[model samples]
Target: MSNLNFTSGQTIPNSVIAPVSADGKVCFYVYGKTHLLADVSGYFPK
Candidate 1:
């Protein structure tokens, strides 16, 4: 359980957070935008 920072820009509506564990975990956060999947996925790696 750590801090994952992803997706942060003026064009972006919100941000995405991805938590990595021993087995590679992924989580999504929709604070403002959820349309930046491609941008977010680039950092999460699937």
Candidate 2:
């Protein structure tokens, strides 16, 4: 898992690679107004 925290009204670019469960779901927790973007590159079997 990966964790990213940013201050209010902060704009930046970030990249993260994390594994997902068999159900293929992701979760995020935020306090205030925030925008997020995600991309899937490839997948590998366990």
Candidate 3:
């Protein structure tokens, strides 16, 4: 998720689809604790 942008019209908390970064390098979208399957390792890996 390099230089990716998110533009949503909904007034969401922004925490649910929290952004996660590894070593502050790769940033990816991650769902809340309820969706553990959305984890980085669960999908993408370095």
Candidate 4:
């Protein structure tokens, strides 16, 4: 995994792949006037 750094007033589209919990939940912590959107492209079986 990699980290993304953004400046103020930056508007770019990015894609990331991360793992979710067993209950299919992901956690995010955002700071200061940010908007987030997520989509699940696919899932893997346990």
Q: Cα RMSD (Å) per model? A: 7.4, 2.2, 9.5, 2.0
Better of 3 and 4 by TM-score: 4
Q: Worst ten-residue run, lDDT, model 4?
A: 1-10
Runs off by more than 4 Å, candidate 1: 1-10, 13-19, 38-46
Candidate 4: residue pairs that collide: none
What tens digits encode model 1's per-residue C-alpha lDDT throughout 1-46?
4233455554534444645677776555455554535354465455
Candidate 3 lDDT by residue in tens digits, 1-46:
3232334543323323344465555344554323212233333344
Error of 2 at 9 (Å): 2.1
Which is the winner by lDDT between candidate 1 and candidate 2? 2
Number of clashing residue pairs, candidate 1 = 4
Tens digit per residue, CA lDDT, model 2, 6-44 = 777778777666767669886665666787777777767
List candidate 4 stretches off by more than 4 Å.
none
Top candidate on lDDT is: 4
For model 2, what is the C-alpha lDDT against the true structure?
Answer: 0.71
TM-scores of the models, in the given order?
A: 0.28, 0.57, 0.16, 0.69
The Cα local distance difference test for each model comes to 0.50, 0.71, 0.37, 0.76
* Candidate with the greatest TM-score versus the true structure: 4
TM-score, cand. 3 vs. native = 0.16
